[model samples]
Target: MADAVIVVALLLVAASATAAVAQREPARQALVLSVLGVVLAVLFTVLQAPDVGLSQLAVGSALTPLLIMLSVRKVRRQARAKDRAR
Candidate 1:
């Protein structure tokens, strides 16, 4: 039972990571990355590392995606400003 859960979690992590990498847009990629982070947290928990999983969930699922989205928004905003100036 435990082995099966671990294997499933591992597979989910792999699939989500691949999905994240395959995304073309930064926003979409960030969304997929957030999902990947949650999947990774699950994998860590299944591996019996709740401490690591908790931190991963907080950082990967939340902070990383938020930062990426903010960065994308800032860049797009700058590009728009530049276009306006032109």
Candidate 2:
């Protein structure tokens, strides 16, 4: 049962990652990646690595998502600025 849960979680993460890659919008892609990260973190916890799981949750689920969001925002701002400058 545990192994099955882990496999399902991993599959969800993979699917989310693929969806993120297929998405054209930066915000949407970031959101998908964030979801994938969270799913992976959950999988880690289920696998009995609490420390690794917490670290993954903190870095992947939180920090990475924030960074991605910031980067997307920055890119959008830059694009808008360039458009205005034209």
Candidate 3:
């Protein structure tokens, strides 16, 4: 049973990772990346590493995605400003 849970968690992580990579837009990619992070956390927990899992959940699912979206927003805003200046 434990093995089966681990396998399923691994599969979810793989699938979410693929989905993240397959995304075209930066915002969409970030969202998918967040999902992938959560999936990875689940996999870590399944492997009996709760500490690692919690850190991954906080960093991957939340912090990373938040940072990515902020970066994207800043870049887009700069582009718009540049366009208006031109």
Worst lDDT window (10 residues) for model 1? 6-15
Best by lDDT: 1
Candidate 2, run of 10 with poorest lDDT: 29-38
Model 2: residues >4 Å from true position, as ranges? none
1-86 per-residue lDDT for model 3 (tens digits)? 99899889988988998899999999999999999999999899889999999999999999999999999999999999999999
lDDT of 1: 0.95
State the TM-score for model 2.
Answer: 0.81
> Best to worst by TM-score, what's the order?
1, 3, 2
Model 2 lDDT, full chain set:
0.84
Q: Compute each candidate's TM-score over C-alphas.
A: 0.98, 0.81, 0.96
- lDDT value for model 3: 0.95
Candidate 3: lDDT of 67? 99
Please write out the lDDT profile of model 2 over residues 7-55, one tens digit for every residue: 8988887887788799898778777877877887887888888888889
lDDT for each residue of candidate 1 in 1-86, tens digit (9 for 90 to 100): 99999889989998999999999999999999999999999999989999999999999999999999999999999999999999
lDDT of all predictions:
0.95, 0.84, 0.95
